[model samples]
Target: MRSERRHVLVTGASGTLGAEICRRVAGTGWDVTLVVRTRDARAAETARECQELGAQTTVVAADLADPGSAEFVVEHARATIPTPMAGLVHCAAHFTFARVGRLADDLHSDYLRSFDVNTHALLRLIDQCGRHMVDDGRIVALSSVNSVLGLPGSGAYAASKAAAEALIRTASRELGHRGITCNTVQLGLVDTPAAAAVTDAGVRDLYAMQSAVGRTGRAEDVAAQVSYLLSEQAGWMTGQTVRLDGGFQCR
Candidate 1:
């Protein structure tokens, strides 16, 4: 039997990875609510793409860093969606490169900003979704391989992502009784606009060499994994961090 189409909420809908996830999920015939931080040209383009795929789409501008934003987003989504949301893919994250020395003064705000969006916002969204979603809802959050790899100059970002994963694990246990699954996907070097902006040819080559696939990952690669995790086939999986690093963590 064909599965009935469902509604999904995707954060960071304007970025490369998030936009691809929105497109991929919509292509699967699911209604999509894009929780973008800003209603930019990119968000509009992504929404247009999803609509073209025949999936109903709604774009909500929200900054996850703000304490009240999650509640507002939940209320907006509940009003806009024709049915209960079945899935939430949190792809929004704040990252700024800095060393341990920067943790003391003005740069302290950097850590706070990262944690506010990467960890606390995720918790707030999941809590709201838990109260409203139908049984068997799926929740997926985007993490980075740096969370575990202990990469230098990534202390704050890694700490925030690691904390997010810890929260997801606990959430899975708590929501399991309701048939909801929470999981995190850890990504490595992906060929996204963000990476392109920071990575030079030498750095890209280094990352490619470390991957078993001998090439960098694409945004679509991460999107495919998220799409699977949101499907009924992944109902039995929860409280786990799935890695899409092309074996970079193994090396």
Candidate 2:
């Protein structure tokens, strides 16, 4: 038998944005299943924080790049949580800096790796989780503005994100009859360790100056949006990519 509480499975729970999403949803009364590539200190801390927020939390380790990991993750969550999944938040992404024209044999591997994690894993997770989701289930995937803007030297990452958005849209249509809503949040520059790793100070400054908000995004900003998308209030919204950039694309 499943628990009466709503449960959500979150991917990439060790990262900044993912952790924030877990905390926000937990605070809003959702039990959490955190999927991490490793059950490290960071992942443990995230789970601990959620539990403190009054959520029943579980941590599972799975490298999404492995084809079998998605099935394993969904199964584990179901077994441990003993609840019908109310939502799925996919935040796992593989990124590398390589220009489309300059990608050599080794670089090509990174390109494929991006799709393996960002696109293929997402497809599998949606499929696996959808099987167990309640009728009003929510699915939210994190995308990048680069998916639409086509940032230079990020061809592989951009393409993979674009593919993810497409998958979400398709899933929304196919799953609509079941009252499941699927959507993607196209994000701008969020000030996170992952963002800092891939960009320099100069690049970050340029993005801030370009945005209408005159600053980069925060993890809380993304978390708030994810929480909303997962809420019953957003039942009518589906098959759309909501741009959460701070007006960065307006210019």
Candidate 3:
């Protein structure tokens, strides 16, 4: 007896990590939806890649940081994507640097933006996804290792991400009975557009040196772990944050 293919929605799909995840799921014959906050010039290539892998895709515009964006994401998923939604990969997040005390003025708005996209929007997406998602669905949100590691300049960002991890655990407990499993992968430093802006060469080298594997994390590496968790093999796993940090947090 085999299960049917699932519809998987991936946020931040225009980027390196999210795009790779979309490709992975689509290769498995699942219908994929890419929730893009803004149009990417490479979107057509991405769509072609997914389509070639035997998955249908629909791209929708959504800024998860916006208050009502979750509803809009869901609406677009329902109206535009061919579904029977089974999984969601929440790869969207907002990050900003603040010393927690020195940058007082940036606190309120930064906190709201962080929570809006990283925490609140995730909860909202899960809730809205419930209506269209299958009973045995899976949800995977991308989190940074900083959620627990306490990076010096990213205190608020860390807290906001921690909040998301907490919610994933709680949601897993409540939704487990419905055959739904919620999990978040706390990734270590990865070289994405987010990291590309870091001007500190020494810090960058330090991160690379810290990984047990002696290399910075890759977007695809994190995405691969997330893909497995979304598969039937991970059905027994829920209510936890899996560390995907290449042993950076091991110290």
Candidate 4:
């Protein structure tokens, strides 16, 4: 185990998957920063969960998509710890459904907006903290399996996530020279609030069966893989995507 007590920051802390990441890392005795939107009750829940897992948590309330919120988020959290951002996990996301024909110029901009939350905000946060990144500091974003298997009405969401992964790959190359590792985890269908958006029961059933494990993914399952990627044991790994879908996309 490393001597330095790491401080990990996770955005989208109000969501199921994001909260799970906090819980898993906290259990390992890391300091956690749970970034959430102001006045969100889920934020309290996440904070409570983190504390239960035995980690000190800093609750940061900010709109990650607001202009310049990225740097602000990083700075506020950094002020809480002296460790120079030992880890960053961006689980924040936005999803909009519209077919290409219905995607007007304004609607098309939604794709960019998704990127703003899921990709650009992450990029800016990394840029602000990358230089001071602790040795082997880990940066992992929660991408989606949809990035590879595009959904018709969710193309914008998928494209944004894919772009975010591309950015991470590039960042891994740049940051590796500075002793920071960057990677992404593309999650499959998980039983989270987000899954409620899918109205097609047949599609959901099909996805559950498609997984070799014969079930939908869980936040804990994804968080377990995330914990490994953030560990000292994973120092050699970077610029990769770990799929946490019960071997759904298997060989």
Candidate 5:
């Protein structure tokens, strides 16, 4: 119902959850700047989809792993948008599966990379965005249920996600004076192309059964929660990590 053409920047905009968030926010008349790691076909496709949904989309290709990419994105975002960034969603993530002490070759680097993108990169982006955020700004990061549960193969991943949530909590307190709210969404298994590539079918089935809803989550489900957090209705909600696991961990 709102059609103000407010601006939002979404990292990992080419991925499944990211794309869904783009479409949903754009539908509500928000202009979106997609921060992508690569300017690939999928990135173009996502941009096209957001355009069709009536949101102006600008794709800036930069790897979040690079230390300066956050500044680069913020520069492009400032130049391209109509207003200061009103919302930000950090959905980009890097994950590698390996049990402790059974790591693959170069696994240490992989663990470092996971934290770089999932936690440190988010911190960088938040710092830049916070400096230029308009009043009532909303910031949301995509987190994982692994942060809370003792999942067998997710040690590094869990640690990185937990770190991101800590940053979000502190950020909410720091930025509240600017009327900005910061939060994270801790997600469960979602049926997406990215998840499909890494998920073992047997493990997937086990997770699906763990849900009170008796199903895995969808990208749309994650996007819907994010959209609400960005809306004016959620002004009072901040510093919280909302879990969207279909009650999977409730058992």
Candidate 6:
């Protein structure tokens, strides 16, 4: 077992999927710097859990929507963590349900916000954090199947995620010479608080039915995949968008 502790920066660290990733990485001897929009109780709890798992934890509150937040997060992590950052996971996302042509007045702002948080922030983090990473570094972003499927009522969200995937692909190519791997995980209907807020129980059941696995995704599923991508064994994998949708896209 690899026991050397490496440092990692995880955005959206207070969200369900982000928190799960933090726990999984921490258990595998990775110290974590959690970048949250607010240093709330939930963020504190996540840091505590990682520390209990014997991982050094730092919580830096920065809203990714801000153009400069990415630089601030990297600098803060560099100052706090003793080790050079080995991995960066961009888990923070902005999602809004706006159908094209239906909400013309609101769609423009929504689209801008989505791209700002999802696409631009990921790019900025890759630029800021990527500079601080060691050789064989890993960069993973949590994307959505909507990026490809273009699900109805998710125009803004889908477009932003698609753009993020493209940026990851480019980053992978540009950073490959340094042994840095950049990838995205296109997720399906995961049972998360964010999902619950936007979808109803009926919608959830329908997603479960559509999935080939006959169930929705779990946070553990995402965390497991993230752990693998961050591992030294995955050094050769880059510029790929691996789907973790429980075969939902197959149907």
Worst 10 residues of 5 by lDDT: 98-107
TM-score of each: 0.96, 0.96, 0.93, 0.93, 0.95, 0.96
Give the per-residue lDDT digits (tens) of candidate 2, residues 1-251.
Answer: 12356999999999999999999999987999999989999889889999998888899999899999989999889899876688999998999998887665666888988999999999999999999999989999999999988878889999999999999999999999999999999999999999999999998998889888899999999999999999888999999999998888443
Report lDDT per candidate: 0.90, 0.92, 0.83, 0.82, 0.90, 0.92
lDDT of 1: 0.90
* Model 3 worst lDDT window (10 residues): 102-111
Q: Which digits, one per residue and each the tens of the lDDT, describe model 4 over residues 1-251?
A: 56656888888888888888888898886788888877477788778877787667788888777877877777888787665578988888988887766665666777667878887888888887685667779999989888988877777888889999999999999888867889999888888867867646786678888888898887888889889889999999999988777768532
| Count of backbone collisions in candidate 1 | 0
Better of 1 and 5 by TM-score: 1
What stretches of model 5 exceed 4 Å from their correct place?
Answer: 1-3, 102-107
Candidate 2 versus the native: TM-score?
0.96
How high is the lDDT of residue 194 in model 4?
A: 79
Q: After superposition, how far is residue 29 of candidate 6 from its true place, in Å?
A: 1.4
Task: In candidate 2, list every pair of residues with a backbone clash.
Answer: none
Q: Could you give me the TM-score of model 4 versus the true structure?
A: 0.93
Write one digit per residue (lDDT tens) for candidate 1, span 103-127: 6567699888999999999999999
Poorly placed runs, candidate 4 (over 4 Å):
107-109, 249-251
lDDT of model 3 at position 99: 80
RMSD of each: 1.4, 2.3, 1.9, 1.9, 1.8, 1.4
- Which parts of model 6 have CA positions greater than 4 angstroms off? 102-107, 249-251
Q: Write the per-residue lDDT of candidate 5 for residues 1-251, one digit (tens) a residue.
A: 45467889999998989988999998987889999988989888888988899878799999999999999999898898776579899999999887877555466887889899999999999999888888889999999988998478888788899999999999999999988999999999999988888888887898888888888999999999999999989999999999999989543
Model 2: residues with Cα > 4 Å off, grouped in runs? 1-4, 104-107, 249-251
Runs off by more than 4 Å, candidate 1: 249-251
lDDT of 6 by residue, 1-251 (tens): 25678999999999999999999999998999999999899999999999999999999999899999999999999899897798999999999898888546655887888999999999999999878899888999999999888878999899899999999999999999999999999999999989999989998898888888999999999999999999988989999999998878443
